[model samples]
Target: MQKFFKVYIPIVIALILTGCKEEVKKPADSPIKENEPSSIAVTTASILKEKPKNLAAPEGMVWIPGGELKQGAVPQDKMAMQHEKPAIDVLVDGFFMDITEVTNAQFKKFVAETGYITTAERAIDWEELKKQVPEGTEKPHDSVLQPGALTFKKTKTSVPNLYDFSQWWHWTIGADWRHPNGPDSSIEGKDDYPVVQISFEDALAYCEWAGRRLPTEAEWELAARAGKKGTTFFWGDDISVLQQRANTWEGEFPVTNTKTDGFELRAPVKSYSPNEYGLYDMAGNVWEWTSDWYNNNYYKEVNTTGEVQKNPQGATIPFTPNNPYAKEKVIKGGSFLCSASYCASYRVSARMGSSMDSSLEHTGFRTVATVAMLE
Candidate 1:
């Protein structure tokens, strides 16, 4: 079989070459829409046969009482990308999850106590960084290298199309979780907001300190679905009610924000209603890190077995034909930037792979604990 791709923009190619940008499904990979029944075989990873007793409930944590899960896009999600198809069934043990994303106040406390610094706070090592780029790529001067994170910038006018992500995403210097927008920006009075500009490493550090771990992809989907099996959007198949349920972009993406949802950027945790699991910001707000090493073709493997997997952790190593040099982890739950016109990653089964060291204003994470962790 012969495959060919047309490169419309050089900047996007450069971003892809650098392996710095967030993953977006190509227009060619757009989902098929029709009144179609879901292909997912129904099975419940549902319920613990016996609940662990005598374990005190952790603060701000809830047990995700599992039920049925179809661990991929349902037929109702017309916007689902090619990668989200071939939904499969799986079982997950009950685990306690943070009610909301790790908040600024919580991360601040961790930094204050441990004197730890985040990836966005460290100066860029061009030599190490360029490894992800081409071998002959020109290096910028030392003065140009600074610590920062990627941030979304609104374009003055609407772009011709949504294919070029670089039109809206920017790598700004001096931007971090504390200074979300930039060095000039501050998180003061927004302690309740989810922490952004957090890398996978940073999330792991926080999880370690909290005596919890990042949820596996299966765990994340199970929690988000919350027994609402074989449905789109985790809330239901209704895209019309997305505004009322999540803090996703509600206007011309990266151009004009109608603020229909009353937020132009990331909203405070619990700004929207929690799902059936009592977990807030699981569908949107900020993309949360997961423990899965994203393999672009892993879903195919899962479906081929035709057997239910138990407590399935994702691929042992990251695999994406787009960027082999970058070891990426799965980031679930879209962000405030996601919209129908852009990436509607808020769907429960929607997934994206981000570089392990990559940090952005729209990216954050939560923690989860097992019964053993408490006992």
Candidate 2:
């Protein structure tokens, strides 16, 4: 029988490129004015008129007027992964999404109410893990089975080898969502910061308790695009502008972070200007979990349908060449670790995946409520 094990691994890749360009000047902070003839506003208006009279948006959430979104990267996007190719149009229904990622304070409330224990706080199951490991492989020490989560520590020098992600990621005991760095660290005063070290199971549990659900990959991309279709970043194609618009690595990967955007680690939600759809931290902060099971060729399957996929829920099953036995889920928006010299997954169309049971220092999530839920 196929078995599953929760293994800690840093799945980010550092793509190094040359050619430094001049920094783009920051644009004036003009919020998306109401009554603007934007696609997002128009769709939202229509939905309000047609929705059930009792339909009301949940507090702390904004309506995403979903419409046709050209998902995936364009042919010219060199950084685009194979899975992000052959950009196709997809349609999703309007839904209410949290304006910011679920914050530490928000998650604390859920925990306080439900008395839920996150996966990281629970000990590993060696009996189940043996199924994934090759037969006869030595069992790890009992100490290794202790509760823990993956934590990122910047290296002392520039890492020439990008493939060896273990150079920066360390599995630390007691590093759950409550103690992000380890047992010693606490979220005490960082109530406004986005909660990290959250596994897919933890996020789902929070959603269930809150009467919400995680957004589908399609819905996530649509909201990240924020009515600006085909743009490299939500703000635009000029990567130089990223320093002012999102929280991303501004120096060498895994070694140095200049904190050019006023943050070396996670920033408080809404630290930057909101996207066109009034969504904050959609590009960078922490990689937000989506409800889709990951599959590299899912887009290919959708394209073969020869019609716009309405509310595509992503692949029916997860598949990854890295570890066939490990089930993975889609994660988007990149994080503080993303940089031009390293993991530049902050682009609107970029995607990443992690094991469903794995939790890390840079991963968090938001919740969504659909029209059906409202009714």
Candidate 3:
């Protein structure tokens, strides 16, 4: 589902922090001696030097030799969302990530081998869903509880209310990874396209069978930035640069897509050039799932420490004020539906949260393999 709620203070604070500022000078009469190695510093240095055993790269994946990232939106972006605020120094360990989003062909292989069924293909559990809803509320109709997914349908005219995303998204029965639009649609010729209509659990299942796992939010952002620091977009600060670099809406969103980027919907996995790290579709195509539980204020926790966060696993619990009972995971990289006039989440630092059980037509994911996997 589209998230358009505006809470601007956090992002404004992030923007202010990104600008050039005077460095704080140490007190001349401070008791601690300068250059004296603290325990934290010593431990951080040791971790940086420790190397894991070399492993053969998984096919269709590339190694990201991660370092510290200024992980958040840059000051140049006035459209920065509140959740992308308070850019912090985060350190992630090197890991192997898929070169592109998990393709339909790849997911098909996993399903065929395991006979796995995705979340969207299963009937909804009314008993479990009732716990999340208000007590004593009337049960939804059986048709509403049928196996289905949220599918995007472009509007014939400009939507009267952009915030009401229901205008473009519909719960369509028989719409899963295989039948993207509905029962009438098929993935017959779209083997190379990134798989969509996936949930966090569905992606995790594929990862388990493949002997991989979803990347942590920190790792995903680091890779998407592609070694670039403090830039609005992954490529650069200029918004115009996105014209040929990614698959995002080129016209007024929901109403019409000009297809200036040669795509009305999802483009092939690597339709655009790879990022500096040799990772393709790192910016758009489909939002990739991360292992971390989402928390809008998670960045504040990262800033509490002087030592760089090493592969942070996000908050202890997922936090969504609107849906407290829904366990949500972080999704990064935006998707084909992103538009400057509507959803600008295509920016590297942007973050979105989706329920673990919620499947949508625009959502997909990639997997990551740690060095330990080799052993």
Pick by lDDT: which candidate is best?
1
Q: TM-score for every candidate vs. truth?
A: 0.89, 0.86, 0.86
The predictions' CA RMSDs to the true structure, in order, are: 4.3, 7.8, 9.1
**lDDT by residue for model 2 (112-184), tens:** 9999999889877777756654567556677666788777888898776665565676778889998998899
Q: Which stretches of candidate 1 lie over 4 Å from their true place?
A: 1-50
On lDDT, the stronger of 2 and 3 is 2
What is the C-alpha lDDT profile of model 3 across 1-375, one tens digit per residue? 113322222221111111101112122231222112223332334333223556677898888875766777676666666566666666677888899999999999999999999988987777876666556755666755678776788889887666555556666778999998888988999999999989888999999999999999889988888888777788888788796899988888778888999998899988998889889988778888899887767776665666566777887987765545556788888788888767677788888777777677788999998777856
- lDDT of each prediction vs. the true structure? 0.78, 0.75, 0.74
TM-score of 3: 0.86
Over 4 Å off in model 3, which ranges?
1-44, 47-53, 305-307
Prediction 1 TM-score vs. true: 0.89
What lDDT tens digits, residue by residue, belong to model 1 across residues 102-221?
999999999999998999899777667677665776776565567777777899997775656667766677889989998899999999999999989999999889999999998999
Task: Name the candidate, 1 or 3, with the larger lDDT value.
Answer: 1
Estimate the overall C-alpha local distance difference test score of candidate 2.
0.75
Which pairs clash in model 3? none
